[model samples]
Target chain A: MNYSNLFRIAIRALIRNKLRAFLTMLGIIIGVASVIAMLAIGEGSKQKMRGQISSMGTNMVMVMPNFQRRGGVSLGASSSMALKYTDVIALRNEAVDVGAVSPEIRASGQIIYSNKNTQTTIYGVSEEYLSIRKLEVLSGRVFNANETRSMAKVCILGQTVVENLFGKGADPVGLSIRIKNLPFLVIGVLKDKGESGMGQDQDDLILAPYTTVQRRLAAIDYINGIYASALSEEKSPAAIVEVEEILRRTHKLKESTENDFRVMSQSELLKTITSITDIMTYLLGAIAGISLLVGGIGIMNIMFVSVTERTREIGLRMSIGGRGKDIMKQFLAESIILSILGGVMGVVFGYLLARLAGSLMSSQAIVKTQSVVLAFIVCFVIGVFFGWYPARKAANLNPIDALRYE
Target chain B: MNTIIEIRNLRKDYHVGEVTVHALRGIDLKITEGEFVAIMGASGSGKSTMLNILGCLDKPTAGDYLLDGINVSSMEKDAIARLRNQKLGFVFQAYNLLARTTALENVELPLFYNPKVRARDRREAAIRALEAVGLTDRMHHMPNQLSGGQQQRVAIARSLVNDPVLILADEPTGNLDTRTSFEIMELFQNLNEKGRTIVYVTHEPDIAKFATRNVMFRDGKIYRESIVTERLNAKEILETLPVEVIEEFD
Candidate 1:
């Protein structure tokens, strides 16, 4: 028999019992839709992370002190004060891959401006800190070497701190604000940088010269951390190695002694976060695939019932010169059409659902073309795999007995 | 006359567990083209079995059965199906019309299995077959929408659509009223008069009286075979019966 005839006949048969056919397709629709939605959300989060990391400067590296042990009791890494200004200088002088280096220290305190006081983090760094962290000064200037030598109480306010201390549209440049009873001059206001992928507010801090914060405010001589930038994105790995060696030599660590400082590049963090999201995507896809398998079983179940109900019809066709293969083809075509119809509908619904989720979560949920193609291929395979048994049963039936069947 | 069907020493046995039931025993029969032969036997007398074997729906255990000079008794399943499609037509007692299908499509079913027929030619042939049974006006009606005699005519139209060498009907009029049965018999008589070979099986002697000859089967063997001395005309008998008053609203 020609395929057109078989397709026409199969379509007619399905249309006869419209409700049952749709119910059979429901399983497949849900299976494919869930797969698309889940993958889109997972892929969207990974993309968001990559964007966040790249925005923070993919060539930048951060060095933090390792954990400190006091009387055999281990303290957290934040308590370790091994990172020093001399280590930053050594990194700048010895490391050829290192482009710019800045010592960093942080303190949290209340800043007051004409009775409007707001609590915020205070970052202490050098003139190169803005370039190393890719931050731009909106107005005025950063602290110079003369201010650093005199331990001048000069600071730059982030957008969040500026808005909190001095309302919107008010330029705080060349204005003075109090930091925990110590008056500090605001030389500039940093431009706004939105929330990171981790949902942490990026513009909720203040920046000042590291010598000013260490000597004038905290009465400390050592620094908390260091920030450095490589010349290019690809050189960050080598830059990390060079910085580690410089720190190791400055700390006077022996060959067997463990280093007291840790160096981390932006791409290394990207790899760790991306790998986690990949596992989650794989897990969600696997769960959705199980539903597809259940959907396939549903198709098989309906096909079996259809074959049994149409035994006499099969026998009649056989008597009229329809071969066994013809019968098999007709039933197989019916199931494949059913699945492909469901697959097409699923793709449409999946896209709509992904868009809805994206809006609801305020993130970009992209439905990839590869996922749509994969789901359709899976549907075709399921149709054939589940349809084979029932079609075979119909084909192998004896015409005499089938005609005699009630 | 050319022989349309020839069978010698046909035997059919059914195995039920350890015992073999002999359904047909050493039967010999021959039917010529343009002949209306009725095989009469009660249930379990092997008439149904013989009809099935003759229609190529079943194979004989031991026999030399030939249709249109082709030996088909020992043919394979697919070959038998092709031969049946090419040379044999079937009319069942149940009418066997696809319930939800229109009369024209039901008639066109047999042509779908014939690879030689194209789409346009198939439709034309199906229309002609419906016209032959005088169902041209009701060609689009479903089987459930028509009366018993009308449905049987549609079945007859389906059988005629293929233009086969022989028409094998088993109890074709078994489920009809007396007048409807006679009406179908008249249609069969009209077709037979047009040089069609017909082999019908029936237990009702009253229904078998329209055939030119009768073969009586008893316990899987032909007990008697004789040509009718005075055959009844179905059209004449139907005219004598009272007119059937069908519901007018439908």
Candidate 2:
């Protein structure tokens, strides 16, 4: 028989039992949809993370302290033996590609006055710190460069801090708040930056000049860490190299001595997160793919049952000048048509589900076109591979015996 | 060599559990061209088995069977199918026409296997075959839409489509009344007059009267042979049968 006739016969036979055929296709539909949706969600999260990090300025880099060994003892970053505040001055003056440098001194405390006390984070840095960290003041005013030089007691509060310290009724500008019993006047209230993509509160801190923190509280001229902005995103790696060299030279370190700080660009952080998300996507896709395999086995089982159910019809066809290969071709065509139809429908349904999920959250629809193509290819292969044995069994039936069957 | 069918010492065995039932026991027979013959027997007397072997639908366990000068006993299964398609036609008792296919398509089925016949030619030939069996008006109707006699007529049309060397029919009129049975027999006679070889298997002696030759089987063997000493028409044969038998059959 020609391929068209085989296809026609197979399709007609399948359509004869509409409910069973539909039930059989349901397995394939579920399998394909699961695989598509899972891959899309995982890929969507990765994309969102990359977008958030990149928006924070690719030129931004972080410098954290590392352990230093005096004899043979090793320690961690919090050991107070690594980075220093003087390193920022050295990087700012000597590093060619550095644009701004600021030191961060952090301490958690409560500000209290007249029965109003609120817990908050206090950060210490220079006035250029606002520009370096991409923070903008919404009210009052930021401290000037001279204010930072003179170890002034001026401070800037973020939106959350202003809300907590002064409430909506009270004015925050020029108000005094006791910090560890040392009063400082609030010079500015920062803009409502809201939450970052990682769910960290961006407007929840109080910023004081670094000189005041060093002298009044810690009583040392050292810093916790440094934040530096590159001249441009394209020059970040060069700026990191320039800053590292300047610090090493000012510290008078030998060639054999290891640096006591870790310098990392924003892009490197983005890469680290992308690798993690990539692994997660693959793992979820694999788990969903197993259902596709199970769906294939279900098809095979039903096809075998179909062969047995129609043995007499098969014999009749064989007797009426049909070849064994014709029988084989008919059954194989039937299963392939079933799976391909299911795969096509599953792609549409999967996209609908993904779009619904994205819209419910007011987010972008995560449609990955490759997943549609990939799901179809895998399902088609499954049809052929799972359908072969049953088709062969039908083809190999004994014509005489089958004709004799009732 | 003029014989269209020749069987020598044909044997067929059926093993059901430990019991061995010999379905065909060393039967020897030869049917020449252009002869109408009948084999009559009681149930389980192997007349059906002989018809199956003659139609090439089954293989005999020990046999030397020749069909149109080819040794069918040694042919492979697929080659036997091809031989049946090319040289033999069968009309079954149950009128086993494909239920969902139209009469014209049913007649054209064997011709579909014969690719030498183009699609248009096959259609025309199927129409002509149906006309020859007096079913020209029912050509487009499915089997269930046709009566028992009309369905049998469609089957006869199918048997004639390929123009085989011989036709083997098993109980062709088994499901029909006396009037319809005679109508079919008349069609068979007319085809035989056109020089087609025909064999019909039956158990009713009166039905066997239509053929010029009769072979009766008993206990897996041909136990009697008889030629019609005097020709009898179907009406006359029905007229001679006892009224009790007719009433019981009705």
Candidate 3:
């Protein structure tokens, strides 16, 4: 028989028992829907992470003091005090790949502006620090070279710091805020940077000249860390190497001695985070795949039952001149139609479900065209794979016995 | 008349585990176009086996059979199926109509397997077959909705839809009342009078008397073969039967 006729016969048979047919399709629907939604959610989170990491600063590099070992007992990196202002000056003067360099010395203290007092970290950095860390001044001016050379008591307040001191949406530029009982002028209010991927608030610190923080607040000679930026993202690795070489020479470390500082690039961090999210995506997809396999088994189970239930009808068809292949094709068509229909509905349902879940989680879930196409191809394969054996069983039935079956 | 079925020493064996039961030891039969023959036998007399072999539903253990001039004894399953579709029709005792399908579609089934008949032609042929069986008015009703006699008539229409060389009925009236049985037999006779060949199996002597010839089987062999000297006219018998009453409800 022609395909159209076969499909008609199959459809008519399914329609004869609507409830059973629907129940059979439900398994496939749930399977495809979960696969699509899971993949979409996984993909969405991956994209979100990439965006957050890139936002920190393009081509950024960080140099920190390495852990110092004293009699086999290691002191943590933060207590080493290896990175210094001279090493930052050496990188700035000698490195070509590194575009900007700024030493950071952190000091935590209570900031008082009138009656409002909030405890926050103060970052001692040069004027180039704003560009290297991708921070923008909303109003007023940043600390210039003259300010850093003169150890000016001028600070740039982050959006979070400003909100805590003067309230939300209040620009505190040109106002004096007391830190460690030392009144410092707020030179600028930095723009909001939101939260980082690790859920840390990016805009909850203050920026000042490294000279002033080292002498007045922290009373430290060596800087805590150094932040640098490459000329472009592609040169981040070269910039890290250049910064490490400059720091080693300034520290007068011998060629055989191990370096006392750690240099890390933002791209390396991006790669690590991307690999983690990729693993998560595959794990979600595999769990969803199991449900799809169960759905295929469901189709096989129903098809077998249908064959057994319609034994006499099969015999009648065979007697009327239907070949074994014809009977097989008719039943196969029924299952294929069921799964394909379920697949179409599942694609639509999955898209909607992903959107709903995305809103609930406050994240955007992306549904790619490839996932939909894959779901369809998988559905078709599932139909044929699960449908073949049962159809063959129906075809192989002896006409006489089937007809005689009660 | 053209010979539609010719069998030579047809044999059928059944293997029930280690036991071998000879269902049909050896039987030779010949049936021609425009003839009505009834094969009558008790249970296990091999009449059913013979019918199965004749319908090409079963392959004989050893035999040379020709159906409508074609050698069918050694044909493959698929080839025999095609031959059956093109040259044979069948009416079963159970009326074997698909449930939830209209009588018209059930009648159209035989023609569905015939590639030579287009969809439109298939429907027209089914309609003509239903008309021939005098069930044109009930053609739209489902098998369950129709009376037993009407259902049998629909089955007969299905057999005739392909316009085959032979029509085989296995106890076509086995599930019907006496009056309904006569009515079905009368319909068969009417079709036979139009030059359509027919073969039926039955154990009831009265039912076998409706055919022009009778072949009785015993012990897996033909016990007797004879022409009916006093053939019963089913139309006359149906006329003599009391008319069925239709009850009215308030």
How large is the interface RMSD of each prediction? 1.0, 2.5, 0.8
**Each model's TM-score?**
0.95, 0.79, 0.95
Model number with the top lDDT: 3
lDDT minimum window of 10 residues, candidate 1 chain A: A75-84
Sort every candidate by TM-score, greatest first: 3, 1, 2
lDDT tens digits by residue: candidate 2, A116-235:
888887888887788877889887898887877787878888877777767853558877888878888888888877666677888888888888877775676568888989999889
**How many clashes show up per model?**
0, 0, 0
CA displacement after TM-score superposition, residue A28 of candidate 1 (Å): 0.6
> If you assessed candidate 1 against the hidden native complex, which CAPRI class would it receive?
medium
lDDT of 3 by residue, A1-406 (tens): 8887789889989998899888888888889999999989988888887898898886999998988788998876444788778888888899999889999999999999999899999999988898998889999999888988899999999999989989999988878999989999998989999988778999999999999999999998989889999999999988887887788888889999888989998899999998998899789988988988898899999999999999999999999999999999998999999899889988898899889989987778999999999999999999999999999999999999989887
DockQ agreement of candidate 1 with the native complex: 0.74
lDDT of 2 by residue, B1-250 (tens): 2899888999999989999999989899988998889999999999988888887777889989999989998988778777777787778787767656789878887775664676668789989999999988888887878888889999898888888899888899999987778878888988988999999998888778889899989999989888877656765554665554323110
Candidates, DockQ:
0.74, 0.31, 0.82
Cα deviation in Å at residue A205, candidate 3? 1.7
Q: What is the TM-score of chain A alone in each candidate?
A: 0.95, 0.88, 0.95
lDDT score at residue A200, model 1, on the 0-100 scale:
92
Residue A394 in candidate 3 has what lDDT? Answer: 98
Q: Could you give the C-alpha RMSD of every candidate to the true structure, in order shown? A: 2.3, 5.6, 2.3
lDDT for each of the candidates?
0.89, 0.81, 0.90
Please provide the root mean square deviation of candidate 2 (C-alpha atoms, Å).
5.6
